[model samples]
Target: MPTPGGYALVHDRTIVAERRTCRFSWVLVDSGNNINILYRDTMTQLGIEATHLQPTRMLFHDIVSGLSCSPVDRIRLDVLLGTNDHFRRGPIWFEVVDLSSPYHVLLGRPALAKFMAVPHYAYLKMKLPGPKGLITVVGDYKKSLECAKAGSKMAESLVVTEERRQSTGS
Candidate 1:
């Protein structure tokens, strides 16, 4: 069993591309998620054109709203984890979506399985096997709190805006 407040704690880390073209500052580590997700804005920041993305007909169901959301596209990128001396690199497929989020990317079970990474939410640490040895990545507590708070605010704002739209019938 996991300890309380784990949900409030954000599990994020820096992810570098094998090509060294771009680096993601905050990537949410979600073990419960089945698929990896990337924001369109982040893809744009990486200088990846929309035309490069492959079309995806998959739709994700939102647990909170029970609504189905379609992804803009899908992309495969080679991501490197950990430091230069000890790192794991692999190709991860991400469903690109246009939304407002606190983190740049959401790394789910697929990403974890690819790297064989184990995440401890309470401790805010993730460990994976590297060529030299085990590579451990620690999460920033301050950044976690900040991202959680921001996410909460964004959710609240969205709900309020939705309610207003419903009331206005527009």
Candidate 2:
């Protein structure tokens, strides 16, 4: 059984300590004194009792707010990560804050932190924000989660459109 705080995946937990990566200098993965963060299981995935993990909802404009009014706006984002860092790489329905840029997916602190995993060139290997490797909901995809039947289909269509753009540079 997978726990809510931590998961059972090796790839997701594994880290490249020696590597140097830094894509978002804007963010930081710090565990300094008084950080009170769990000493083990990465800073976010606390092995300690002091570090409390907070769960929150994210809208489309949360993370991608920086890309507003841009041509790449309105692109449906693969919910690369979700609240509680459970879901990864799937269609996440988020409310758009700005109509001009519908495709830009928002990145809350959670998404920013998780996707930062794996060092880029000169940063601490970011811990996996969401489920990084093989994750199966292990229930009913159609029954338990069906309200999304309509949105899921729409997301699929958007994905196709993005794929085409990536392949043809259009």
Candidate 3:
């Protein structure tokens, strides 16, 4: 029998983001999501001060648990996609949230639409128009598998902990 959080392996697409003085990799491409999200830790790592963030009253929901989440703030940052020879750079508004995720940033449909990008989940690739030609971003299968494993482990641990709490009536 399949274990909890151990379903069929799903291909998770990732991309690289380049800014003026920093570069980040393993940014999750989530087509089902409506907005882009930046983890708080990633913001700190990028040396972005909290004062730079703009206040927001938007609330988002977790697709799995149906839990509502309020973002800490929002920020507009220039994100460069693709290589030097072929790339697209634009300002993206990201909702900064405090959450634990395998990826530092989650690019949703909004970002994809801004870039006019198309993603092929089966092939683990995304393509967009670039200055020179079409820029194709390939995903790392090994990294995807690793992330799946880590997520599964985390979910299993949560279930075990919940069961223990219930048994102890805590």
Candidate 4:
């Protein structure tokens, strides 16, 4: 098990784990390109086989409630430790917390509180310091940014030019 702030060197570059409960067995994702995971070939990769993994309420750290009481089945992931700020102590504990409806889980100021979160924007590469070990966040920023820019431009114009090119903002 890797310690906090420690990197799990795999192949050449360090690899972070991407764990999720799919419709089949639990999946463990590794490698950026040509991704590999611990799952049988015949699987949907979302919920359990035959049955769909519907959103269900589960107990997570209650930041506001302080103690664990209100358990929610929100898909949003809540970061416990590894936030930007840290005292003499090391990273903090993480829990699968949830929030009420309407407040979408986004990389806003609060969600991006962790110093590593912004890296996801550039490449979605965030170093998540878990209790057992540190997991690197692998993300692609350039591609997403370009896609978003194009989408917004299209939304604003709602018209395709002869060259299908967008006019530079004047």
Q: How close is every model to the real structure, measured as TM-score?
A: 0.87, 0.20, 0.79, 0.27
Candidate models: Cα lDDT each:
0.77, 0.28, 0.73, 0.29
**Of the candidates numbered 1 and 3, which has the greater TM-score value?**
1
- Top candidate, metric TM-score: 1
CA displacement after TM-score superposition, residue 26 of candidate 1 (Å): 1.7
Q: State, as a TM-score between 0 and 1, how close model 4 is to the true structure.
A: 0.27
Name the lDDT value of residue 9 in candidate 2: 16
Q: Which run of 10 residues does model 2 get worst, by summed lDDT?
A: 32-41
Put the candidates in TM-score order, highest first: 1, 3, 4, 2
Lowest-scoring 10 consecutive residues by lDDT in candidate 1? 11-20
User: Tens digit of lDDT per residue, candidate 3, span 1-170?
Assistant: 22332322233332223333466555777788898998898888777888889999889875326347899999988777777667788888899998666677778899889999887776767899998889988766666666767766765675677678889999
Candidate achieving higher lDDT, 1 or 4: 1
Which is the leading candidate under lDDT? 1
Tens digits of lDDT, candidate 4, 1-170? 22322221111121111244222111111222121111112122222232321244434232222334332222322223232343111221121223221111123233334433333322335555555456554433333344445545644443334224535532
lDDT of 1: 0.77
List where candidate 4 sits over 4 angstroms from the true fold: 1-105, 114-124, 141-146, 158-170
True-structure lDDT of candidate 2: 0.28
> Can you write out model 2's per-residue Cα lDDT over 103-147, one digit (the tens) per residue?
112233333343543322122233444455533322222221232
lDDT of 1 by residue, 22-131 (tens): 66657788888888888888887777778788999878887236346788999998777888677788899999988788888888899999999988877888899999
